[model samples]
Target: MLDTSTDIRLVKKAIRGSVDAYGELIEIHKNYLYRMAYLHSGTEDAALEIVQETILKGFHSIKTLRNPELFRSWITRILIHISIDFHRKSVPSIQIDENLPETRSLGISIEERLDLYEAIRQLPEKYRLVIVLKYFDDLKQDEIAGIMNIPRGTVAAYLTRARKELRRSLKEGYLNG
Candidate 1:
């Protein structure tokens, strides 16, 4: 995460066609962007492609950004667009090696993590985007609304519905599988 002042400086420099500043901004946000893309696509290759496309699109349009303060959100919006486009064209298929040892984190087993990820992937696109943007990307409702081009209230509503559906799906999965 970048401080407000540094972000402003970087945005200004990037807007001036400073590739180094653009590179710095990308370096700061790339990991989080990759994680979000990976969660959405469920494959490292697709995630990398999404990130790459996002960089290309963002770089080309950086000069058009009116507000430097919104740089992160703006770039994130680009990434979301690319992610949705990629998802529409590709069926996410990541094969897990059953023989490999699964690591545990925060009391959740790898299988449990995979289950949650699969469940999210199965959600309707609107609900899935809202859930992923809100939780995975740590974006606020207003930010998600801006990125999705929806009303803030709509974002809130989608999040509420998504959480309910996720709970139901997890419960069913636990009972059956």
Candidate 2:
């Protein structure tokens, strides 16, 4: 005789033996995760795979999570790792043309955002991870540190360096023009 009200609490606790609860988590976060994966991968098929893989792994490891409130950040970190791993194995040399247009434009012209994304794309893994986690995800430095299991000072340094590098890239663009 399980009621709907009790069902929710039960579901949250059912990370041990219930696929339904996992499905609920997926239903809630799948679209957002797919968007994040698409931003990182630039392909729908690859992004879908990343989302699916992330959900699968996260579901299997839910017991390791101590706080339910950390679920989003936890899942996001998993997605980031999975996306980077896929890129490393699949893309050799990670190339990008400085002149290529940004893809996020709709009405306001996403040129700056695209430029930023391109600059980020050129960064080495460590710096790039920090930038994406901080800027793109709009995460606080402390939250980024928590999810990354890193020092907050390291997060700040990465963001600072990433900003400098992006500025250099933009300046190069102007000089070329």
Candidate 3:
């Protein structure tokens, strides 16, 4: 991961029209963008397309970014918007990818992870987004609020409700299984 200083430098260069610097910045964050997109869209193809759109949009608007250190957040906001727009324009289809990376270090079995993802998929869009941004991306609530253009208190409320719903769903699944 690039340090904040390096990201700031690259952002400055990109703002000065250095395509190479911009390319490097995108490369550094590509995996994160892909993961975020995939979590939001639930399909590899949609994730790839969303990432591509995010790259293009970021490239065009790099100069408009006011804070260089917040590049990740800014680009992430773009990806989220694109993902939401993509979903709105297309028929919603949720398919679990069997080859999702293992989280054994976190002591989560594949079956459990799949069940959690399925539960997340069933959530409303705002709730799902909060859960993904908070848990999956490890973003702070304030950051999530900024990215989603919602109040911080709203982010907290959504997170609380989302977690509650997820727990209920997972518990029911467990009991039913």
Residues forming the 10-long window of minimal summed lDDT in candidate 3: 100-109
lDDT of 2 by residue, 63-104 (tens): 887656667787888998999889887765444333432333
Local distance difference test values of all predictions, in order: 0.79, 0.70, 0.83
Per-residue alpha-carbon lDDT of candidate 1 for residues 62-167, written as tens digits (9 for 90 to 100)? 9999888888878888888898899888856554333322222324566876677778888888999998787666778988998888999999999888877888
- Report clash pairs, candidate 2: none
TM-score sort, best first:
3, 1, 2
- Against the true structure, whose TM-score is highest? 3
Off by over 4 Å in 3: 102-106, 172-177
Q: Which sequence of candidate numbers ranks them by lDDT, best first?
A: 3, 1, 2
- Candidate 2 residue 103 Cα shift, in angstroms, is 11
Can you tell me which runs of candidate 1 are displaced by over 4 Å? 92-107, 172-177
Query: How does model 1 score by TM-score?
Result: 0.85
Q: Which model is ahead, 1 or 2, in terms of lDDT?
A: 1
The digit string of per-residue lDDT tens for model 3 on 70-118 reads 7888899899889889989977657878877432243566788778888
